[model samples]
Target: MDPVLIMADDDSDHKIERRRGPSTSTLSFSGIIAVAGLLASGVATYNAVQNDIASLKRGELYQERTNERLSEELKSVRIEQRETMKEFNEKLDRIIDQWARGRKQ
Candidate 1:
């Protein structure tokens, strides 16, 4: 097909010319390669994002397990502390009773 051109004339003997606009048939092989490359880049980016999300999920699961273990350890320590305190108080009471008896005699 013959491409159309626009011509403009001014009164002072000056002229302007414009070429026809490009159509889909005018797209070159390089343009097609560029489009394909863009699509591939998008796919690569999406895969990277998915991998990042999976890694974060694994890290979150590990953290949850660690927290549970720490909580159990803390409970055990508290129970042990309570038992130690009870034994100390009993020993103090017995010593006080012995001192009182000695003073009476």
Candidate 2:
């Protein structure tokens, strides 16, 4: 190669090298931070979803228990009403019989 041309090419290469210098370390650090942030966000989202599922399950269980309790209470009330109705009918029949006897006498 000619000396003058080689020297000019070396100078140009040096300028390009300087312009592109030492970027890998900065890019590597930035990539690491980005990955860390992504992982943290994913973990937080997973935990929130798990908590929501747990809450939904608990709510379902509570609703089921409430329904059972209401059904039992309704059954007890119906039984009591029937018993009361039976007693009232017996008393009414006795009153009618006594009134008829008194009228006949």
Best by lDDT: 2
Candidate 1 lDDT, 64-87, residue by residue in tens = 999999999999999999999999
Listing every candidate in turn, what is its Cα RMSD in Å to the true structure after a full C-alpha superposition? 7.5, 7.6
lDDT measured at residue 88 in model 1 versus the true structure, 0 to 100: 92
Report the alpha-carbon TM-score of model 2 versus the true structure. Answer: 0.70
Candidate 1 accuracy as TM-score: 0.67
How much is the lDDT of residue 25 in candidate 2? Answer: 89
- What is the C-alpha local distance difference test score of candidate 1? 0.86
Q: Once superposed on the true structure, which residue ranges of model 2 sit more than 4 Å away at CA?
A: 1-22
lDDT of each: 0.86, 0.94
lDDT for each residue of candidate 2 in 1-105, tens digit (9 for 90 to 100): 999888987787555334565588898999999999999999999999999999999999999999999999999999999999999999999999999999999
Against the hidden reference, what TM-scores do the models get? Answer: 0.67, 0.70
